[model samples]
Target: MMMLRKFKIVLPLFFVASLFISSQTNANTDPNPKDKVLLTILKYVLTQGHYHPQTIDDTFSENVYNSFLERLDPSKRYFLQSDIDEFSNYKMQIDDQINNEDLSFFFLVYERLTQRIEESKPYYKQILENQFDFNNDDIFDVDYEKSSYAKNTSEITNIWHKQLKFTTLSRLNDKIIAEEDKKKEDETYQTKSFNELEKEAREAVIINMDESFERIEELTYSDWFSIFINSISEEFDPHTTYFDPVVKKRFDISMAGKLEGIGARLQKKNDYTKVSELISGGPAWKQGELEVGDYITKVAQGDGEPIDIVGMRLDDAIEYIKGKKGTEVRLTLKKMDGTTKVISIIRDVVELEETFVKSSVVKKDGRTFGVINLPKFYIDFDEKNFRSSSTDMAQEIERLKNENVEGLVIDLRNNGGGSLKTAIEISGLFIEKGPIVQVKYRDKNPDVKKDTDPKIQWDKPLVVLVNELSASASEIFAAAMQDYGRAVIIGGRQTYGKGTVQSVLDLNRYHNLKEDIGALKMTIQKFYRINGGSTQLEGVHSDIMLPDRYTYMNIGERDLENPLKFDKVPKATYKLWDNYENFNQAIDNSKKRIATNNYFKLIDQNAKWLKNSQDDTLIYLNYEAYKKDLEVHENESLKYKSLRDYTSNLTYTSPLYEQPLLEKDEDLAEKREAWHKNLKKDMYVEEALNVLSELKIKPQYHLVKN
Candidate 1:
């Protein structure tokens, strides 16, 4: 673990003046004025404001060079070893170039990249023009990271040939299976021959390939520059990134939790626009049609014909989806379960109310407990009247307290976190008054954020639910609760380990340039737990570990590329909340029950199987072998089907106090009903309830202030 320390160095105006005086030759051939200005502002911020600034030397240059190359051609599809060899001349010179605010290296690489892309477009098209032999036993390595650049043009051509064959075979296989299924459904259904299906698959590949090349051709120099700068910035840390103007707007919308259109976040996965997340109370979430893993293959507005989005850039596809609040967008989506459907969604303001704190009263084993689902630590900085998570959470706790609930569960699962101020205030609700988290800046002493308030709201037996997606502020709250013995952390092995704080500095603000140069989201600090441990890559461990599908997955800060290392500092002086002295006994009982419970055991087995399957990257190119392998995996997966239907006998309803409000708002009633129904099927929630039941401490006990 590396603890954060601050460095305060004020460079005089003459220092920047001298840098320009010594680098006049480098500017004569600069690619663009915006790039030059962007370079100056970026360099100044990274060196002066970044948390862990690496020295601008040969080592740093090498990292930037390699990272840029990887970003440009991640699959090793465009660039060959020959091109890399030719580009090595500037590998060790990028650092010096940065010092001079030069961009000669970028221009050189961009020219070559564009040329190569134009030259290579014919290779794939030519390969897909012929039929592929489905009988050939071949394997394709789907993992791009393990692949190396082609040694020569011949190898590049061969790679394209194999890739086209795999694509064509997959399409042809699906077509054949669909025809077979149709014949089974209708006795008079006409079937096409294998040759005809293969021909159609090849034609589809060519059409898709042509559109892909066309989209690739639409990339502007600024887009490439954005990637270049981000590559340079991310070398400092994975969280430190350069967002172009367009992306900055998107970031703002996401942070604000208000957007038009279908209210779903989309990402490009291998030329297909995939739904990453659905805003909780947004149109998409309310529609209950689109899912996280669904692929949006086509989009249409109003009653227009659907336009294919496959082989289109994610940004371009998003433009078609986003519209006025009253508009309508129809999406043709392919579900992960191999089902296709066209879903029509009416665009709206996407209220974002569902992300707020919502509580449900659960009656389990003849005892009532309150469960509060907090999606994120959201806050509105600009508007004082806007509802924040901390304030909303406090009110919810008060409501739950009035209901005489025995124990409370704060659900932080899938919470990516936001607003550190809100997290600090929420921590105050649990503890009387002490340090909750420590923030360390470069070369400066760690600043401990303390909750000075003496009032402890609902200091009862508590449980905090977390998973792999629980991050940053979520980690802080959970770590503080665990450190103080205030609450038992449950779910997953640990939370998402993003402990660093990022400050987005607008590049245009630093310079007098008229052009919008976007912003730099740089890591400026690392936060540590009150107990001296930094959550950086390790995150906060669950007090009571529970296995899920993500248990064996590498989806944390540690798994991310170039994350800040974890380290410790001196622990803050804070007193523990000793309300639950028999906490260890409760943990033991819960573990024992989980081991014997068929639901949990099945989940662990399913997680193991998922991990094993993910590790196998090679896929059979032959249709028969590929189909057999998929069939076997799907059949093996059927045993865990009962997990989805497994429901706990726990009955959930709004408290009597909240019942009137539910009746007043039917929408709220539906939301609560849907949430409670999901909770009944949630194995993790069931275990948390069990843990609460086993706690020796009762809600009536008053915890002594520190």
Candidate 2:
């Protein structure tokens, strides 16, 4: 892997990892007995992260793997399954320093290359000077084993890393000196001595480099794929992505309550970077200058030549985008068609404190109801001005109380979670203080996170709105509220099962091995509800699943590969409240209404049709029949196209929605069926909202289970 110079952040899952926020509480990292028991229980439940080879062409004939290895080693003719699967035996304990071809042939090849490099150390410079070619078809006529270079290539390759490190020291020093000189030139009056700054920068770069390499070599393909996918995803749009746990953690950390640059979600499609989803009220959304589907072609400083960002890795791209807040950056964009435009986005220090600074009200359900839309359950790092999600939620309740709202809805849908502290605090908003969540560790006892405050923020009838996107901290708050019988969990069947907690291991911070290279993020903990239940693969179950068309869509944690499974710990001591007696009646009434509702019925029928549709893998050739079938289905799939502006923003908006099922007019029913099948799911979201309305005003039972 090629190393580059850069700054760092506890990336991926910022909040969960607790990377940079200085005000974060000293996490409850102490060892305990219950944690050990839970760890034992979790050995099987926690990690479904197996790298199952999907293609049986486990043989090298699969062009993808072939191209993959070729990129890594130019002379690598081919690798066998024996080379790949040999490591199946070493499922958990993977080591690179040790030669273990017994692990797999992939290891064999890797070791082989390492051996080759080490055997010919002095000649390591040859690689940098020349390209490593496996398919010499592009360059030489020599036999595969025969290279133009000296035969002792193994020694050279093995020692290349360390030797190059030593050799590059002078180059690093020179660069440091140059940077120091530049800093002095830019200095107004006060400046650090060149020697002092140079020393710090040099140490930072070298140590970061070493730490980064160690982490990179040990990363599994599954982990590597997220970074790779991220690199690819940016070209499409910013929101859609595939983040393995590690990267996901980094994301949390990078955006923790606006700790980084202007808060905005980003995705990569290809060499081109596209903006997708923007945080509704964050810097980007507030600016209202950027839009989803707007492709970011280049990112520059307040004033600088637009850098051609094509083909750059996603991480590098993000590093470029993030810097000291309050700075100004210019982004050159490409519109949907091909129109080019440039816009300036000012970098603002994300004022995460805004998350808990206040709350609002929404009048509904024949009564004024308080609305607390918490996108993330965040906590401020400072104790003096500690703005926690729970604390803020409490304040919102006070305002709502003053407004005299009869009911309240805590919207946790699409919430990916943040502070555990906030989750407990928020849950306490509706109940008498008690344990809200149980946290288990790998080698210690599980601890009950309790709300010690004597006062309840709001005791009025409460409802928690959740969807597949609600997870982790979201789950904890919702689950606690539900377990306490203080609120109704309404919306989807369950939330996203991102229940694990991770800690950041600044491989560089603590070790200072590599300088410009970033740090390693590791999964080190798991969370559980105080009642022994966990929000893992099975997120918090809703009291009532709503009727919505999007209920048909595939999204959230359960859809993820190798997600952690669900299991429960022992129940905790707590008081449960029961007030709504018409819960089931309300659910039944809603279901009956939805059964006859037009939008609900059409979506239901569409979903059923899609369930049995073999349209995805079929073919038809009749032209007349094909055109008819394609025409009808295309319109049906987009049954609400005229009603809903669901443009993908890929091509320009069509003047009419009467586009063909098959753009080329090839298949008849097959293509039509495919379109309908994929289009049917989103109807569920509508169904969900309907379910909520059904149970909105049923008779209440005030007695409690406690």
Candidate 3:
């Protein structure tokens, strides 16, 4: 569950532990062999070809080092002066080449960023200064009050920099940057230059700034708070984190995607809670006349005239949409391509069945196998953590068995994992009693989660589907299954590879100041496979590689600031399942053949185009060129068929809701309330089903001849 801490847990930087855990670990105490061994292995794995960054000067300040140490020790549980001393051996010497002038350049850039952030303050002031016009129908059209967050970060950093009583910011950045680069080099990795990277980063920031700002308004007080806390962690290190109260609620919702509402997804598009996507089987989707991309213009309650919601905050809009499931509501919508309509539907308890164990039959190449598409390794957030995706999956396996299905394909495409407990529980359904995954914290003892339950759920021939978005818990389940030789992994190169565990911290508690601000989401520990490999940056590998745009090393936890390093520890004491080796070899052979196929080449070309399109700097041009290029590329990317995946099914090419109204509903008054319930939670269970059902071809159909 997304838990937001009500209070921050602040403390003096360190507590002397009685462990001298690793050569690089700081706790001053007798080390446990398991912990020490793990530390040594991780230190070698993460630090071997990399360098750590710091910004210390002649003053030999320890604060920068302290901050770095504090980040690794999210709980501040294991690090001590002794650990700091251990790291000192590898600390870089800040030569003149990398001194103030160089550092100041970056600081200057940061300053400009801050100035822009400050520019937003006045905008925020305008919002707060303007009184809500209750009499006017435009209350929902109120714009966001801007705030000075980026500027604040700059201010905080500058203030801290001046207080540098000890370190230089550049020195600090260089150290980490050097370390990362060295690691990359050691691995023979490919990356862009700093100049190019900066350009790319700038464009991305510019594009996302408005989007992220808008998101703040749409987010629940808790969701917004959780993200705020998470971003705070980014300031310290990609891993150190904190949380406020509301976020924890969101984490709970993620496991099940359950919420109190009409079961449709809403977005604050230009000025309203836009119906971006309608949840299948939900009240709205069942209405038959409803279309995707419908922009909701107004909403009304019992006996109340419909209130215009053009510019309302997404969170506020949500409050309007959620009520007792049996309640009735009406919506006046504008379609995207230009159409309008009034639809009335009743709300009811909407269950996300697709997030549960969904099964289908894949009949291809004269072979029939039962397919269970697990979009995510979800767990129930409700009291008692009563239900989980794995538990439900086991039940589905039983149902598939009833259908006399042969083999199984577990689809995890775009499935970012939800619950670790569920990942292990679900993996248990495949393998015999053994360690499911091996977890190692910075200074704590290694924690080995197990699937020791002797009873296996379904050990039939199986395959796991993974893609760029399959991360965290998804990697765990897939990896464990592959390790046990229970299933073959299929899809992208690996996964998103976020094998770290994060816990929310209330920074306000620790500081006892500004408790009203958001909290932090800190990375406390890193997870590993029973085989001893960390899932940090390199997610699980697939037995069968598919042509996908995300196959490149473009995203995930590794790309963030203050990220925990990837490494490995001792392998857990677990038995290796047989026959899997042979399965992998066969898969390898299949992949080799597909890699050289002509069709695959076209797919790869499209993948590259998609990737390039995401890079903003690539499209820059001076005035004339900008306009010309924009025209030429207007819909070049759209011509690609894959985008259709995101386009909701509709009869018109234009966005459904923004269109002009053809005719007003004659029964509007009668069904108005009933229709409102149909317009809320918008997820894609039905679409996912369509994907599965359509995929039910025989093995012969899987191969496409040239």
Top candidate, metric lDDT: 1
- Model 3, span 104-173: residue lDDT tens: 2222323332344354433332332222221222111012112111233344342222212111111222
Tens digits of lDDT, candidate 2, 463-560: 67887767788898888887876666777667776667644323323222122223323344567887787777777888767543335544455554
**Candidate 2: residue 679 lDDT (0-100):** 30
Clashes of 3: 90
In terms of lDDT, which candidate is stronger, 2 or 3? 3
lDDT of 1 by residue, 1-706 (tens): 1222343335566754554444454456653666776787788889888988989899999999998887677557788888899889999999999987778898888888998888898898778767787788989886766787899899888877777787677667767987999999999999999999999888877876776677677778889889889878988997788999988998888666566777787765554687766665688877878866577877879887455675466777887888889889999776553345679999987676777888989997788899999887887757868889988999999989888898998899878787788899999998889999999997788999999989888777899999987888999999999999999899899998999987776666555445688988888889999999998988999988898877886767876668888999999999988777589999988889888888888889988887777566677888889888877777777888998788888899987777998989998898788888999888898889889877766344543333
Estimate the lDDT of model 2.
0.49
Ranking by TM-score: 1, 2, 3
After superposition, candidate 3 runs with Cα above 4 Å error: 1-233, 239-351, 381-385, 507-518, 580-582, 616-627, 642-706
lDDT of each: 0.81, 0.49, 0.50
TM-score of 2: 0.52
- Candidate RMSDs in Å, in order, are 4.0, 18.9, 18.5
Strongest candidate by TM-score: 1
